[model samples]
Target: MIEISGKKILVTGGDGFIGSHLVEQLVDAGAIVTALSQYNSFNNWGWLEHTACLEKINIVSGDIRDPHFCRVITKDQDIIFHLAALIAIPYSYIAPQSYVETNITGTLNICQAALENGCDRIIHTSTSEVYGSAQYVPIDEKHPLQPQSPYSASKIGADAIAMSYYNSFGLPLTIVRPFNTYGPRQSARAVIPTIITQIASGRKQIDLGDTSPTRDFTYVSDTCNGFTRIAQSLNTIGKTINLGSNFEISVHDVFHLVAKLMQADVELFTDPVRIRPVRSEVVRLWSNNSLVKSLTGFEPVVSFEEGLQQTIDWFLQPHQLTRYKPGIYNV
Candidate 1:
């Protein structure tokens, strides 16, 4: 237990999937958390709106692309967790420029703001997508990056920009790359959410893309802990550490296991749109998380089957299942 009591922290993208979970944990850890959810006319906080802790924390609505707002928010903060970005891979194909602007340019703003505010630490959230396909099994921090998709290319750019801040300005920034995080409050755009929603909606035929690719899926809570662990430890400054379960499973195997858990015999149908371009597809991804374990003693607490069960139960709720379009493919 790292003591974060009375520490002022800023969490960008605090409305989204993993970000919301981080906010919940930060609050429990006794931090004065300021959560920045993307601004909307509907005033929707996304997943954070449902959190019981929302009433106790400061929720700011703004876009990280605005450098002025970023600078203003960083003032008086002890730590910054930058996570705002466009993450849907399929949409990135159509809006590559948007991905660059949000992921790269937005990161630049956060880094600059953190520097100006003299923030003690800035934990930049990165993705394993920056490592397109596995050149070798159990990819480590030294793995070569080959961006196989537009989304991945943008992330690579973002990671470089973040590291530059550390190298040039001596900013105390750490990049935490989490692999394939899945859990409750996740959007239907992800594979786990897609499968769970389809089954919850009583779909007899589930739509899917290529099932050959493998991924290392970490639960949301574990991923969140990695961020806090890096923040609390001074040894992690200027380091790019991984937060993963160090386990791999194919899409086909995951779908089969999920079906068994639900006791539903569903058939999978191939969708051309759901499939990545032939060369752009990453065939496998497995994490080598020993670096993080050595630095922070961080390990995933939730087992795959246990996490899957929790996600399934949450999506099974009538209101949550209704939010997803089971019959249509989500981009």
Candidate 2:
């Protein structure tokens, strides 16, 4: 079994959703984890601030786009988990160039640093957004990359750059591609949180965009487990693997399920601002999880209903629900 014991690991963007959870799991597995957040004036650690494992990690604040910072922080690290990225598709439309700089160039910096430091492994995080809409059911690693939006295009670029390092310079790295990951501590901008926050805030009318698009949502913890497992698999280096539940659900269906569980009467209204341009929207996403299972013996441990219930309960807390502005259409 892949053991993380005593490994010196650096988690870029460990302050964010999946990254923070990964840090906690890695620490519990006995890895000496270093958590890095984007340098902010307020010194906020994002969700990492609330983690009970906070004291066990070495927290640092710096931007990965800075080459000097990337090189400095990655030095002497045993493994590097690169999770930093500008993930919002709507935001990418407004700032496509920022996505290129952060997603592509920032990734370049990390790969360079990892190679220079002689890091044992570099598990670069990738999103299924790179695959855009599924051209076919059970989209596998070989799926053609359709850049339906600026966000997916940048990730495609970033993934290419990462793999080149392994092919040319022989940098030890594995591309961990996860389908829609959702759970507690996710940003309000994500769909699961968006729906939960609006319902929790007593909004009878929920403002949403197109609800026809289908996504394969994997729980955050399962995605993290995939990363840790990939790191432990020596044969997975210089390869790309997927972490997903191999199931799919459309937005409309997902909303209905959430409403039933919460017993909340919420009406959906399509907001123009929330809808993606027709061509830019990914109409469907279904993951082919066989590769990950074959490689790492990893499968989602949590059922969709169970995970959703846990998520709904977390958002029900007044203090947590208050953190999101349900009325505002978060892009």
Candidate 3:
């Protein structure tokens, strides 16, 4: 097992929901961490600004689209967790080129940088969206790639680029494909956050798209843990592993569950604008997590109900709730 302590780690997109949580956990485990936030005039670090360990790690603001910049920051790092990407499905419909440049080209840049720097490992992030509507139950690592949305198409390309580096250039890399993950600090663009924020913001009627599509939702902490475990295992090198709960739940069910947990009586109404094109909608996703478990002996500890309640508790906080504008369709 590779010890996490004292290892220099670089997390691209460390300012994002999962990346910020991963940065915090790596710091707790004694890793020297550098978090990359997207460059902006205001110099904000996104969710990383709210973390307790913010003072302990270095924060770099830059875009992964630039190869020169990628090389500069990846230097001296022992491992690179490439979590940066353009992930919104709705936004991708309007601006697919942005997704390609950031997700596909950006991954190519990271892989090249890691190779030049001789990093020990690279855990490239992948989403379950690449699987599209599952053809069978318990989608495994070998599940066929079907890109129903532009965002998923870009990710499929990104995963291929990362894997090609491992296969052709011998760069030690693992693709950590996580199913839908939810928790505190998640963007309101996601369903769980949208539901929680709307109710917390005093909306009696919740606007939603098609809610019948089911997903295998893993909590953010478990997803981060999976990333670390994948890094520690030598067997995971050059492998594509999945991080998921192997459980499935639909958006309609999740809405009712969150409403019950928050003690709010709400009505859900389908908003035409929120609906995806019929052919683009991914109707089902249930993960087969046997690979990650066999490789690292990792199992998700948090139950779906428990995670949902925790998410509800966080969004209920007035200070946190104020940050989200539930009235606006977030995409």
TM-score of each: 0.98, 0.99, 0.99
User: Which candidate has the highest lDDT of all?
Assistant: 3
Better of 1 and 3 by TM-score: 3
Off by over 4 Å in 1: none
What TM-score does prediction 1 earn? 0.98
The whole-model C-alpha lDDT of candidate 3 against the native structure comes to 0.96
Overall local distance difference test of candidate 2: 0.92
Task: Give lDDT tens digits, candidate 2, residues 1-331.
Answer: 4469999999999999999999999999999999999999999999899999988999999998999999999999999999999999999999999999999999999999999989999999999988987888899999999998899999999999999999999999999999999998999889889888888888898878899999999988999999999999988998899888999999999999999999998898888889999899999999999998998899899999999999999888888887788888766
Kindly give the stretch of ten consecutive residues in candidate 2 with the minimal lDDT sum. 322-331
> Which candidate number maximizes TM-score?
3
Which tens-of-lDDT digit does each residue in 149-198 have in candidate 1?
89999999999999999999999999999999999999888999989888
Evaluate residue 121 in candidate 1 and report its C-alpha lDDT on the 0 to 100 scale: 86
Better of 2 and 3 by lDDT: 3
TM-score of 3: 0.99
The alpha-carbon lDDT assigned to residue 304 of candidate 3 equals 99
- TM-score for predicted model 2 compared with the true structure: 0.99
lDDT, model 1: 0.91
- Sorting all predicted structures by lDDT, with the top scorer first, yields 3, 2, 1
Q: Is candidate 1 or candidate 2 better by lDDT?
A: 2
